[model samples]
Target: MDRKLQRSWMMYDWANSAFATTIMAAVFPIFYNSVAANNLSEGTATSYYSFTQSVAVLIVATMAPVLGAIADYSGAKMKFLRFFAFMGMAGSVLLFTVNEGDYLLASILFILASVGFSGGNVFYDAFLPHVAKNEEMDRISTKAYAFGYIGGGILLAINLVMIMKYDWFGFPSSKEATQVAFVTVGIWWFIFSIPLFKNLKEKKVGDPTEKRDKSYIAIGFSRIGETFKTLKYYKQLLIFIIAFWMFSDGISTIIRMATFYGSTIGIGTNDLIAALLITQFVGIPCTLFFSKLAKWISAKKALTLALAVYVVIVILGYFMTSALHFYLLAVCVGTVQGGAQALSRSIFARMIPHNKHAEFFGFYGITSKFAAIIGPAVFGITAGLTGNSRLGILSLIVFFIIGIVLLQLVNIEKGEREAKALEDPREFVKVEVK
Candidate 1:
């Protein structure tokens, strides 16, 4: 492995996770609720938050594959990554403009930031197969997730302190501190992303025998059509996607809505932020544990264990009525959040043809993004209808249950073999990563 390149790739996680932690999980939801959407009812605020998140992901889901295909056709994966990173960074920085009763502005910026985050992630994930050998995929992927936890956690801790001690920072109120934190996330994200741009090279894409029009846009669409035609040939990979789509939706909803849900039920901001901190700090060690467990048991089994934990967490969430229950639930979530997501990335990387990593990972991104749709939309609908958040939380179990059952039908090794069989013979011989 190229150690520098690998480290560079991992640093992108460190950079972007600030968006995940400070903006997505900890500070912004609270800000959006108490300030931006203060005009709305508690239930409506929660629904709007989830709905905005769903819309952001839905936009990315529609474009992921096409953008990926264009990148592959033009050998411009890094360029696409840069564009989205900037878009997300700009959105993060602009979040400082959101003031009380600025729900519309908040929604627009949040969606833009999310699209940038999710879009950049598609290209970042595609780099996995190019940088790591098949045997090293789990370790590398987990390491990236571990770095994300530590980096995101560290920044969130600082942001928490700033919010707590606003006077020391010369801010008159916690609200000002939070607005500053949004800007801080943008700076942190951009600073950390530099290494990936500097060190990691975009692998050449588009096979020698493949034909395409002069326009990359046309070729991108053609490539997607061809990929669709071949989907049935990779049965295990397809099965894994179906499984991942369901369970990942459940996980994403929990992360995006937990604080809002807690707040809606009368949890204090202090306790909610503290619980997020617990999840972040506790996740550091737990994520590493899953990486080791993957080596011992296999990535698939480790991921299965993580998903099982999620199912348990969702069940517990339904019964949560106090800070203690919320705290315990956060701890449970921390144990599996990174592990499940990282192992899924590695396992999928192993199953796909490396030459088409961007395209396949685009499909991976779409499944995840679409899953974002189902879970949050369901939560929003349930909450809107019943006027209770507990039902919304409990409803996620169906996704996890369906995911676990479908996961059992997938055979990772067989998927990898099938993918390899489809690769160009000469290229396969030149770099026999397996």
Candidate 2:
């Protein structure tokens, strides 16, 4: 890909990530549970929130594989991206329409938006191979994530100011300002995606071979079946997937539950949002630093280091009894969060067959969605059973440990050789079809 196109593609991360920072990670959940569901009891609101998030993950997990297969088969990744992007933006815009007592409406819209956000990532990740070479991928992927953190942080900072300084804008309270922030995320997401549509080439689908005898949907299901059947053949990939599923579960749990945990510990809302904003910005430089670190240390070792940091963070959470401690922990998490995730994506992309990028990334999406489900479910359940939410937070250490152990078993050189063999120019053709 040309430099312009690569930059354009990366900018999409800048565009869509505001939603993750402001709405999903930082502000909107608290707004929904506290302001939108103000009429409901605390337990009921928490239950509704958890249920909605789980439903969204379930839908994504069920559909992502098929959706990815179709994108690969059709060679219409950008088209699929546009479809999901619209869904996400539209759902976000609908958030502004939610009233204080409209908990169910808010929950449903949030679920829709979450599905769109996660689903869009499947196609977005598939673009990595198209845009970058193996040598450049880790840096490019990490840079995109770094840009995402900056973008998300910038928006969250502005939103935080808006909410904090509501009286200056003639808004009656922080809640009203927060409603406006939801609208801004929708607008931001929609506006930033335009560059990708304009600049990137649509990947061309190959002409069907004479032996290819299935309808597209049939091919999709067959491919999915093949993927599962061949899982054992790719031992390193399978192991990495399991490791990603486990460790990312812990990461997702911490992100999704952080606000609630802060509230449970009597931290103020503004303080929690401020801490999250700090993480977003802090993640920017750290992401870039870790990308460079990957060149000196292996990506796997770097990720292991990040997971070690997570273990420390989880341990610290057990001892945190004050807002200052939460702030300190947030800074530590910010340093590793973006870098760890970016390296994971790049590493997995390195292992998979580029010809079937979307199909494999679809499986990647499935693991991510399923992992999201597992983390929150386990955290919520353990928190309920123990009547001590911090205990649930601490339980995440086990996931990090397991993931690190599994990661060590993967032979990176072997995985690279297999991918390169699949990509041998003499063995492949780029036949274009109408």
Candidate 3:
């Protein structure tokens, strides 16, 4: 394995995670509420934020797979990654100009930034199979998640301090500090990303001698059609994707809506923020521990164990009535969040052909975004009908249960064998038109 290349790949996670933490998770929502939506009620501000999030996810989910196919056909994975990264960075930098009553501008920039973040990740994930050998996938993936935790945590802590000590920085208020933090995130993301662009290379796909006249875009659409028609032959992989979609939806719902739920149950904003920080820092060691655990017990079993824990957490969430309970739930989620996700990526990496990683991981990205839709939608519907957030939290358990059931049916070894059998992996399977 090329250690330097592996390190470079991991650094991209470290780089982009600042956007995850500082922009998406912490500073931006609060800034949008206080500054951008100054003319609106708190509830209205939150609704606008949710609207922006949904729009961004919708755009990326629709684009990921097509772009992935195009990247594979054109050998332009790096080019796509660069374009998205710049889009995200420019959006983040532009956020510094947002002021009171600028909700429209804020939402637009956020959507662009989010599209960049989510879109860039499609290519980043595609590089995994290229950068790490089959045996090394677990370790490399977990290490990247760990780096994300550490890097994101450090920057978030700094941003927090800057907000709290705005006076020391000659800022009149926390709002100014928050705006500066947005600019800082853009700089941090861009600087750390330089290594990946400099060091990592996209693996070529398809036979060089097999020439076709199809334009890259045309081939991209054709590949998507081919992939859909051939799904029947790859039963295990298809089942795994379904199971992953369900459980990942549950996970994403919990992450996205946890704080809001906590507030409804009487947890203070400070407590909620602190609890999330705990999840971030706690995830660092736990993610690395899962790497070792996967090596000892296999990725499938480790993931199963994580999903089982999630079932317990959601059930407990139904009964949680105190700040301490919320904190405990946060810890439980922290223990498995990074580990489960990292292992899932590695396991999927091992089951797919290296040549089609870009295309397949594009599907992976779409499933992830789709999950973002499912969990939240279910939770919202349940909460609206029952008038209780606990029941809404409990509804997520259904996703975990169904995911576990489907995951049990997947034969990882068999799937790996089938995927490995394809010499021209880009073919996936032969397409037949009726």
Q: What TM-score fits each model?
A: 0.92, 0.94, 0.96
Poorest 10 consecutive residues by lDDT, candidate 3:
425-434
**Which residue runs of candidate 3 sit more than 4 Å off their true CA positions?**
208-212, 423-434
User: What lDDT does each candidate get?
Assistant: 0.89, 0.85, 0.89
Cα lDDT for residue 261, model 2?
Answer: 85
Residue by residue across 1-434, what tens digits does model 3's lDDT show? 89999999999999999999999988888788889999999889988989999999999999888899898887889999999999999999999999999999999999999999999999999899888998999999999999999888889989888998999898999989999999988999999999999998765666667887988778888878877766666667889999999999999999898988898999998888888889999999999999999999988899999999999999999999999998999899999999999988988877776566778898999999989988999999999999999999999999999999999998888877767765364445452211
CA lDDT for candidate 2:
0.85
Clash count, candidate 3:
0
CA deviation > 4 Å runs, candidate 1: 38-51, 207-212, 382-388, 424-434
Model 1 over residues 135-174: C-alpha lDDT tens digits?
Answer: 9999999889989999999999999899989999999999
